[model samples]
Every structure is written in C-alpha cells, then in structure tokens.
Target chain A: MAIRYPNGKKYTPPNSEVKKRSIKDYSYSNRGKTLEDEIDEANDFYLQRQIAVIHKKPVPIQIVKVEYPSRSAAVIREAYFRTPSTTDYNGIYEGYHIDFDAKETESKTSFPLKNVHPHQVEHMTVVAKQRGICFLLIRFSSMERYFVVPLEMLQNAWTRMLTGGRKSISLVEFEEQAIEVKPTYSPRIDYLQAVRKMLP
Target chain B: MAIRYPNGKKYTPPNSEVKKRSIKDYSYSNRGKTLEDEIDEANDFYLQRQIAVIHKKPVPIQIVKVEYPSRSAAVIREAYFRTPSTTDYNGIYEGYHIDFDAKETESKTSFPLKNVHPHQVEHMTVVAKQRGICFLLIRFSSMERYFVVPLEMLQNAWTRMLTGGRKSISLVEFEEQAIEVKPTYSPRIDYLQAVRKMLP
Candidate 1:
C-alpha cells in the first residue's frame, strides 16, 4: 500500500509488474501480518501503558480531485502516492525525538542499501545530527531476525555506497553494528528496550 | 476544507450545509492564505535554517476503494476523511520532541472550545504527560493576533468546559496565559522562538 521508491530514480511508475513487485517488498510471508503490524502493536502497548508515544505517519498522497456528491461526504476521486521525505514512524520516547524506518528483506546474507532510500537517509542524518534518537528496524525475514541499526551505521553505509563501496550491509556487519531485538507477546517488538540499551 | 468538529457532538457528516460552513470556518479574509500557510512557511523557514525539523502529518483518510486504471496511477474511487487522533505538526527542535496543532478562529473576543475535539485533547494530554513540548498555535484571524497556548493552559480550559464552565476561552485569559507571536516576512510566524521562551 506504500510506495518506497523515489519516482524517477529507482521506480518509474506506470509499470504494473514492477509496482506489484514493490508492494511485495513490504509483505511478510511467515507472519500472518506484516512487520508494520508488529511495530504498531508495540506502539499500542506502549501508549496504553503511557510508557511512550509513537506513531506511523500516514502514507503521503497527492489528492488531485475530490467529488462533492453530497455536501457531507467528499469522496477522493483521484490521488497519487507520494514518496515520504522522512521516516515512516516518529514520536517522543524518553523525552527524545525518536525516528525510525521499519524494513524487511527476504535475503539472509545481506540487506540491500537500496531498500533505504537516499532522501530518507538524508533525513535520518539531519535527525541524528540534531541529537535525536534515529535508527532503522531491519528484519531478516528468512532468518526471522530483527535488528535496530543506528543512523550512524546507516549513514556510513550510505556514504560508502556513494563512494562506490558495497551497496548492501552484510548480516555479519549488522550483527556487529546493530542491536538485535527479540519480539514478545504483549508488546510484539520491544525495540524501545533495545533503544534503552543503546542509549548512554 | 477541514472538519474540526468531532462526528457525534459537533458534526454529523452527511449534512451538506454544516460541512460547507466548516470549510468557510477554515478560510480567512486577510492575507488570502489560511493560518496553516503561515505555520507551514514558518516550518519551512525553520527547516532551511536548520533550526528545527517540524512537519504537518497528513490528514487521515479511510480509503474504501481504489482503482488502478493505468499501470502507474491508482485512483481513489471512494474515501472518507477520518479525524486525526494526534496533533498534526510534530518533529525535533534542539533534541526536543515538538508537537502542536494549528487553529484559527474568526472570533476576536474568544476562542471556542467546540473547535477542539475531546479525542484530540486526550491525545495532547498524553503528549504533555510524556514531557514532549506540546502546544496550540491559535490564530485570531479577525484581530490579526496569534498566540501559542501551552498544553497546560489548553488542558485547563478543556477541563473547565467538561465540568460545565464556559465553553470558550476569553481573549483576556489568552493574553495572560498564552505567549503572543508576531508574524514576519520570511518565517511568516516565528513561533519556535516563542516556544524556546516557554521552555524551561
């Protein structure tokens, strides 16, 4: 339902097959629900306990046309999905601005750098520079493993790629740089607990 | 354009005239653009200067049906505007979690409580409880006056209304409780400076 690709660069739209494939990028097979669902459940658990307040921002869409059939219900007639400039989820956690993107890959060996866009990387860099808690929740879906990769690690990978380095972060690299988060029943994915461990 | 009213109490959305009236409520006579524009411009100014990273969250919508007529463009055939559960604008400023709602009224003497939904107030209360900087950017368009009312003041007014007190906050109270912000040429409304003054 969300388009992660920047229009001209990675994904040129009007290609039905490619678009369909992009949607598959977000869907998880093992779990009945997606990784987004796990994070949402965790957020809900936190909100209920007043432990933290975080939310996935709405998918940005450019509304071109609206039909006012009746005075009350204005149905959106035409809208185009817009690539988000910032991360998907952000909120206040432990009096700090928390910003992160949740991504999952089918690959067990490496998570492609292309999964995280250039623009999002730029936003995360600015956020981390501002001393906000910025990171990525990456899931190796095949291995059923999740890791919270800090923005510093992401920025380094992104910079290295721009300089003609490897275009993906290896599993071994993730194990060293990122903190692994274990999913639990009540909170689903307790990434915040992992966040606490990472913080000074 | 925007429905500030909650569904049951203030707004019953199948009615056309009330909906049209609500659209008019968002429009302004002077400056042409709404107060939302002023805030957006200010946010842009802040962003350009690297002062803050604040953005308005997208309007929540219940998408009933979408049609992909072409390979690229997916048209929303049927959709309903859902009320936002949280404050619209939020981001990081000097490592602080910033959250706020922008509101403007035609009334010069008072700001109506009916404009703020119970659910939004509940959300704002939780935000303030988390020690995130939370406030309301209220514009009295009739008098060309703007004020940033802290969440504590807003909560007090909301509580008073809920307890059978005045349904609106008087201008006199706003002058005393809220910090007045002057609009400028570049930033449009430099409320962040006002925010800094309010913060401990």
Candidate 2:
C-alpha cells in the first residue's frame, strides 16, 4: 500500500540510480548542499574538537499511529509535523547559552521579513532577556555572503515593519549592523568567530 | 488496523468513557499522576508566570517513511525511536543554563544506578564542565520524596558502581549530598529552589 503524508503527497522511495546520481552531484559541486547542511557540518566539527556543543533541535512531530513491526522496532504509521516553538540551534559555548536559526535566501538585495516567524522572534526576545546569546545566521546564497545578525537588530527590523516601514532588511543595513561569517573548508561555516566578536 | 508501540504493546485511543473515568480517578487520588507529569505541569506554570523557560526536549525519532494524506499535514508511516544524546529538560533560568532529567523510582531504601544511562551521565558531565547547571531530579515515588542530585554526586555514585560497589545510592547518602525539592500547587515541582541552594 502506498503511504501518504499529512500534506496529501505520495511518498516514493528514491531509486538507487537517483540516489547514486545525487551523491555524485553533491560530491562534485558545493551548489548541491543547502546553507543548513553547511552549518550542520560546522556543528559536527565543533563538537568533535570540543570547541563547542551546539545542536539543531529535532523537528517536532505529533504521532497519532505507530505500529510495532517487531519487539524492537516501532514504525510510525500516522504522524504530523508540528510547528516548532523555538529556533533551530541552541547549546553552550564558552559558558554562554547560544541560540540561533540559519536562514538562506537567493536574493542579493534584501532579506524578506516573511522568512522569520513571529513566534520565533518572541522566543529570541525571551532568550535574550534571559541573557542568552541569540542571533540569526543568514546566507545570501546568490551573493555567497553570510552574516550573523543579532536578535536586537532583527527586533529593530521587526518593529519597523510593524510601524509600516519596509518589509525587508536591505543589504546596506546588513553590511552596517551584522557581522560577516566567512566560509571555511574544514568546518564549512565558521560563524562562531563572528559570534565571539558580538559577545560583550 | 491496531497500532502498537516499540515495546510490542497495542496502542488504544482512550475513549470518552475511559477518559472520563481516568479524570475522576485522578481528581480524587494523588496516585494517578507520575513524577514526570507533575514536573511538566510545573514547567508550564513557570513559563506561564514568566518565571522560567525550561522545556523537556521532545523524544527523538528516526523517520523512515512519510506520506501526505492532505495538503496541510504529512503523516509519518515508518519511524523508529532514537536514543537521545542528552538529558530531558534544559533551559535558562535567572541567566543560568539549566539542564536536567526527572527520574522516578519505587524503591524505598535506595535509588538504582540502572535508572541512569551512560550517555546521559556523559552529557551532564560535559554541561557541568561548560559551567551550566546540571543535575538529576530524582523522585522516590514510594516515599513521595524528591531530591535534586548534582552531577558531581551522580558521577561519584557511578564511579563507585564501576569499582564493584553497591549498585544503588542509599537514602543516607542522599541526605548528605542531595538537595530536597518540595512540591507546590502551581509549579508542581519547585526544583529551582533546590537549584538555588546548589549555586555558589
């Protein structure tokens, strides 16, 4: 029987040929990976070196039906993805509570405010109030530029939007207010160096 | 088709009659709820009051198959429960990074060492080294007693067990090393008070 997702999309297992092709494509080109993948690689590197212990929170799901196919394996037969209440990444680094979300955009001129959810903004505000280091890692994929924008600046932009201002943050504002994070070979994205500079 | 859990137990949705009976039973008896439930309620109270931001990390699951049944929801058809790499609860309180797990035992004389997992112990150790507050909220349900045992004390007990010592921590040791946490109405488990006493 064919399986169905909550979004009414049919689930088709990737064929071996497609899998092989994708693997070859990814191995040959940096364009194959998303910004989130690069950040995850960086997190793994940081963890192995004991430099930091950050982790992306797992996607939350609400399970309605589960089937125990064996004594040790439970297969979820019905479940829905739930909206996450907080940002993607959070952990400790140098005794600081670190929390952030990585975002990618193809546009080079401005980042759309719609990319960020209001609840996430509220969560960041709360974390910051608790003295945690909260920020966003935004990737301008078209320009190949990455910036670490602190929660305060994001909040300012959000407020401006609420007051009938531009609905996006311009590249000019990003250059002035955000810290640039250069890409690296080993860790992939060394955004922490930018974070270290932001720390008081 | 009937659903089942990883343990091979059949999953039955609680009908309204069963639910009503359970609610009445719980309303009249203190035996109905688990320690974890009380702690969750307490965390909710704390969050509602803006006193703390602690949250129990959702159980991690490895999704193998998902099907779209509708445009708005994706139903997972096959998934397995994954072992979590860290403790259950973590968040910020009073500018401090707090990480802990709540454990309940029916033992009257001693808490069994088997209840704590090796990976969880290692995680607590790492968090402590990072200067984050890490501990175990252990409840002797039989005695209706809860204690906040610091990672240091837990490490000591684990080490003793490794050296062929008793496989459980005696109540006497708890009196000397652990801080007692009293239950309250709103924040069902006021563990932070115990945490405050542990802080320098």
Itemize residue pairs with steric clashes in candidate 1: A14-B72
Candidate 1 displacement at residue B158 in angstroms: 1.0
Which portions of model 2 show Cα errors greater than 4 Å? A1-31, B1-31
In terms of lDDT, the poorest run of 10 residues in model 1 chain B is B4-13
Index of the highest-DockQ prediction: 2
Candidate 1: tens digits of C-alpha lDDT, residues B1-200: 24432121122235332333445543432245567667778888887888889988877767777776766666666666777889889998988889998887779899998878787788878877887998899988657789999988999998898899999999999999899987655666789978997776
Model 2 per-residue lDDT at B63: 81
Q: Tell me the TM-score of candidate 2's A chain.
A: 0.84
Model 1 stretches astray by more than 4 angstroms: A1-30, B1-30
- List chain B TM-scores, each candidate: 0.84, 0.84
For A1-200, candidate 2 gives per-residue lDDT tens digits of 22434332234344333344556444433454566678878888887777777877766778787766666766777776888888878888877888899877779899998889998998888878788899999988656689999999999999999999999999999999999887666776789999998786
